[model samples]
Target: MPSSSPSAGFRSGLTASLPITLGYLPIAFSFGVAATRAGLGAAEAVFLSLVMYAGASQFLALALIGTGAPLAVSAVTLIAMNLRHVLYGPALLKQAGADARKKHAWAWAFGLTDEVFGTTLGVLARGQHRFSERFMFGIGLGAYASWVMGTALGAFAGGGALEGFPTLDAALGFMLPALFLALLLSVLRRAQLPLIAVAIGTTALVSWLVSPVAGIFSGMVAGAAIGMIRAPRATKGNTA
Candidate 1:
């Protein structure tokens, strides 16, 4: 059953977020170093993580700014890339069922990055924990804090911080995706395989032909469309 005590829920959520926190540290560190190298100051790099808080999008923003893409274009591209995030709340809440409280959602929802959402959903889907807004808040807070901390350290460390550790630098780039993928596979079902495959293929194709940003957006659209079409069939099969 979902913990009714707010403190208990919060603590549990924080504990569960440990893995995400660890995963984010290196990646955020990488971003910080990259940012400074790209001409941003330590404070500026930290500000990006603090305010924007969009993992991949922040990197993309840095790229856009570095390349002298008009600020308007950069803004639009960032928004388009992260558009899929809009669906995360509804999907998570739906999985949480009617009993899941939303009174604190406005605050907690801000922390719902791809990894955080996947982690919470995995917990609920696996019956490891009942849905609690406080719990969600804890998870989000922990992950966010770690990310910011990592970014600060990296920024201060300067661009050459990882120069001696070439292998580590390369590995950091993969951590975000790898972490999310692990979370996803935890909740994977045979019925969802086709949707995942379609999304991956579309993303890869678009990215290869055009740009990574365009690919991500197209993949999201394709995945959502496929998911909606497949939902009914899955429901019917379950009922039958």
Candidate 2:
């Protein structure tokens, strides 16, 4: 189906978003339980999920809230962690209209969680162009709704629902790591694969000696520097 038709696009979007909805429910429910434990009211927890919309970052920020980590540190770390999306924008720069692009970019930046990015990238990789925005929006909206709903449900049930699902809860918590591993495996290009392995090893070493976050940032910077240094130079006539 051509992606240009609005109806077709909407369907494509909906289809693309299915994986995220499946994955987000339990995780979002866990977040809700955690937020309630942290003293946020039911409504407040839902509100945080709706407004912040970045699951892992929200969890990390909430975890650090009482640890005396300055708000600025949390904010900067979240921003830096999400900066990877800057790489996703150029590829999709063609699909969006001017105003829609701006709105999409802002929404995308705020909502750039693992599942959403993964779903969107998958949709694009399927050779669908015209429907990419609708597909992305569908995924984002589905995940967002699931997050809010899951949190609300969790808050309403309090501890009862959690008590009945211990093993499931543990599995849900591990989903993010599993998703990251899958993503890393998917993007294993020739040059990039070796660099990622080296970066991971270096980051592991630094994390044992220093802060995990700092180690991660340092490893990414080092890998990027190495990639640039080894990049092939363009011939003079190729510029035209």
Candidate 3:
């Protein structure tokens, strides 16, 4: 296929993110409601959704805030929670074209939310290596639009709805972990992947017994260590 213009690529990227927007609407609405209950004003709730955009981290932070956790504690926890994004860069680099690399890297960095990453990766895997910027933008803009609208609705209406529907809130809280588990399983199809998963699980178990922040960091470190140790060695015998 011929190369696409920047605008077209952006549009394509945005359009490709449509499925993500659908999923994010409800999730973002839940976030808006949670943020409101956590003492954030409607405007602040909307702002957080737009700026942070990290669904799991934002939800966790809002939960902490509602519990009267210190700002530092919440901030640290959110950072720890998002450490997994660091692993996504190298994987994406392999798929993006030279012209799209810089812009895509930026988008991947900023739009590293779970749904966007999944959708973009699927698109790249399908041989649509040089997607229009419009595609990416469409997804981002669609998601952003849904999030803001959901947050506004949730903030304004969530409290009254919650009074009669307690189960809804609890269910919404469970979505993030469930989504992460699904994503983990998708990537853990090979034997080599299990070692890293085991390391992460072990670290998290240890951390839960001690400190949340320490546990998350320890899990990441453990995963990285296992991946490095398992990497194939380059020997003279194997050199061409």
TM-scores for the candidates: 0.91, 0.75, 0.70
Q: lDDT of all the models against the reference?
A: 0.86, 0.64, 0.66
Give the per-residue lDDT digits (tens) of candidate 3, residues 6-69: 6666677666656666567667887777787778888888888778878767878777878899
Candidate 1 at residue 164, lDDT? 100
**lDDT score at residue 234, model 3, on the 0-100 scale:** 20
Candidate 2: count of backbone clashes, pairs at least 3 residues apart or interchain:
1
Reference-based lDDT, residue 170, model 1: 80
Q: Ranking under TM-score, best-scoring first? A: 1, 2, 3
In the range 1-240, model 1's lDDT, one tens digit per residue, is 646587988998999899899898998998899999999999999999998899889998888989999988999989988887888898788787765789988899989998898898888877777788889988999999999999999999999999999898888778877887888787777777777788899999999999887887788779767878876866233201
RMSD of each: 2.6, 5.0, 5.1
Error of 2 at 94 (Å): 9.1
Q: Residue 46, candidate 3: how far off, in angstroms?
A: 1.0
Compose the digit string of candidate 2's lDDT tens values, residues 87-206: 545534532334134445565455556666655654443445443455556666777777788878877666456777788878888876776676555544555654666688778888
Candidate with maximal lDDT: 1
Give the lDDT ranking, best first.
Answer: 1, 3, 2
